[model samples]
Every structure is written in C-alpha cells, then in structure tokens.
Target: MKKIKIYLDYKCFPIWIYNDKGELIGNDLPKELADDKQADEVFVKIQNIYDNLFINDLIEFKYIGFSSEIDREGYLKMIDDAVKLLKIKLGDLYVIEEKIEV
Candidate 1:
C-alpha cells in the first residue's frame, strides 16, 4: 500500500471596529469614519500597518515526500526525525494519509 502524509498550519486574524456605544461596525467603515477626521486618519494608518505586517506576510512551509519500500516502523522513525530536526511542536503538526490504488 502507498500512503501520503501532509502537514499544515492554520492562522487567523480578527479586525474589530466599534462605535461610541461599543457597537461593532462592519467593513464599510469609511462612511462611519467621515464623522471623525482624526479617527479616520488614525484608522487609515493602522490599516496600512495591518496590511503590511499581517496581510502581506504569512508563514509557509514546503515539504516533499519520497517513496520508499520501508516498513511502518521505518516510516514512523523518519517522521519523528523530521519533526525533531525541524523543531516542530506536536500541536502544530498535521498528517494526512492517502492510499494509492495502483
């Protein structure tokens, strides 16, 4: 049987805008910002920072799998070695297995 293993990381960022009464506002914020010029300017600056720091920059990894006729123990040892060498935590590791119908 042939199998494949996959690993990935999921990330999320939340943006929040609030009104005077602490009411949450949606994405159409420019209209709301019209009421406060100073706030609007600050908001634009913060938004630019967010775009440059978070939106434009994201972490990613590329891994290539090689096929070998090793036993299950050997496969597991290889995975363990990779995780240790890469300094990856158990919580951040993900694995997907696929069977090749050949």
Candidate 2:
C-alpha cells in the first residue's frame, strides 16, 4: 500500500489533521468562532456534516485536515472515524502515511 503525507500550517494548533497513515492532512480553523464553546459547536457541526456524508457513502477520504479550532476530543473522533471508514472500504492491506523514528 502507498502512504500519503499531510503537513499542517503553523498558525493552527492543538488539533492535528491526519491521513489514513497518520499523516497530517488539513487545517480546520472555524472562522469567526466567538469562544471555546462556539468553537466546539462548530466542530460538532462539522463532524455532523462529515458523518452524514459518510453515511451516504459519499466520502472516500485518504486524508482529512483540521485546524486548532477543533478540540482534542473532536479531532480524535474525526480521525478515528475517518480511518475506520477508510479501513472498512480499503481492507487491511491499505498502507498509512507516517514516518518511523530512529
């Protein structure tokens, strides 16, 4: 299986987007969020959007990007769901994007 790499922008923090192989994917910065709660709301909304898309089997994602606007839990759920769905479709032989530490 092939691996893909996703790089996050410096401005985004906390939430780290990733591809199936654990490569950083995209930045999810919800613009105009008034506060943390609002930010979380936006994340939930985004997740809902993604979830609906996934339910319809419309999205086949090799990578997903998220900005700092998404909290830790939110980011985790998104990544988990993304990978789970991808794996379900691609099977176990799929390769993930990541690096090995020496």
Candidate 3:
C-alpha cells in the first residue's frame, strides 16, 4: 500500500515574524507607538493575526485510502494541486510538505 503524509508548521509565521520585526526591544518603539500601552496593543493585535492562521484550514482532508495504484496517483495529483494553491495563497509562510510512502 502507498500513503501520502502532509504536515504544516503552523507556528512558522508567528515565530519568524516575532524574531524579525518584534521591535519590542530596548523600550524603543516607532514614534507612532512610543507609548508603552499602545505598543502593547499593537503586539496583541499581531498575536491575533497569528491565531487566525491556525483557525482556518486552507484545504480539508482526513486520511483517505485508495483502492488501486491508479487511484492513488490521481489523489496524489490532487494533493499536489492543493499544495500549489496553498503556496500561492500563503506565500511560503508555513513549512509545508507532502510525503508518499509504500
């Protein structure tokens, strides 16, 4: 039997964004948010965006089995298509992968 496995590193974006632009450093924020309370609010909003990412499923699929090799290949093609679509929409923000095993 052959199987396909896919994984999503859902936290990839928040981690990358935080490390790169989380300018909450050294008590220095852009003038617009120099106020500590406002900077904290902006930080909270960014966190909300990160949370929304996990709430939405780009494509929905559970473990589905195929009866024959031909069917398996066809389904795999569909998965490949889905992955491409996701890349277009998500812009490589998530660590995504697919694996086929026999």
Candidate 4:
C-alpha cells in the first residue's frame, strides 16, 4: 500500500485551494497523484474528512468555556477519530500516519 501522512501542525485545517495575486487553482498532491476521475472523486471524500477537522476549533472553545480548561483527552480523541476515519477511507490505497509536533 502507498502512504498518506498527515501532520497535526496544520491545526487540522484542510487547505485544498491555492490562491495567489491573481491565479487560483486546486492544490495538488492527492489529487495530482490521482490518475483517474474516479480517484479524484474518492480524494474529494477524503478531503472532506480532513476539512471537518476545522470544527475542532469550535469544539475546543466549547470545552474551555464550559470547564475553563483544555480537555486533553477530548483533544486527543478528536485526532484519534480523524485518524480512524482516514484509515477507513483510505482502506488499502495508502498507509495513514499522523505526525505530531512537540
């Protein structure tokens, strides 16, 4: 199987679009490597999985507001859930590895 490594440093933000002074294009990689339209479609689903991670921000706010603290377990669970979902989506297509920065 191939490999898909996700870094935790991007704040779980999904940046699939590339915009510059004037030019706008879809960021490449998973899409570029996707050789067929079907593959691109699958990647779109995968992109959504990553995109949803952005919600963690709001969740974090809720946690802090309710408890005045950061719930480490919940925080880590969010990441773990994302990883599991990624693996399910990827199936055998690629190996999923998450990189966390300390």
> What lDDT would each prediction earn against the true structure?
0.34, 0.40, 0.39, 0.45
- Stretches of candidate 3 off by over 4 Å are 1-65
How far off is residue 54 in model 1, in Å? 4.3
Cα displacement (angstroms), candidate 4, residue 101, comes to 3.6
Descending-lDDT candidate ranking: 4, 2, 3, 1
* Residues 1-102, model 2: lDDT tens digits: 333222222222323345556665544422222244644554455445444322233664333433344554565565555444434544544443322110
Per-residue alpha-carbon lDDT of candidate 4 for residues 1-102, written as tens digits (9 for 90 to 100): 345554532223321333333233433335434464544444454444444444355346221121322544554555666566555655665555666431
* CA lDDT, candidate 1, residue 64: 26
Across 2-76, the per-residue lDDT of candidate 3 in tens digits comes to 111242233322111212343322322223334556334443443343344344456763333445678557655
- Kindly give the stretch of ten consecutive residues in candidate 1 with the minimal lDDT sum: 1-10
Model 3 TM-score relative to the real fold:
0.35
Give the residue spans of candidate 1 off by over 4 A.
1-25, 28-33, 54-102
Best by TM-score: 4
lDDT of model number 3: 0.39
Per-structure clash totals for the candidates = 0, 9, 0, 0
Weakest 10 consecutive residues of candidate 3 by summed lDDT: 11-20
Candidate RMSDs in order: 19.4, 16.0, 15.4, 9.5
Clashing pairs in 2: 6-24, 21-96, 21-97, 26-65, 26-66, 27-66, 27-67, 28-66, 28-67
After aligning candidate 4 to the native by TM-score, how far in Å is the CA of 51 from where it should be?
A: 14
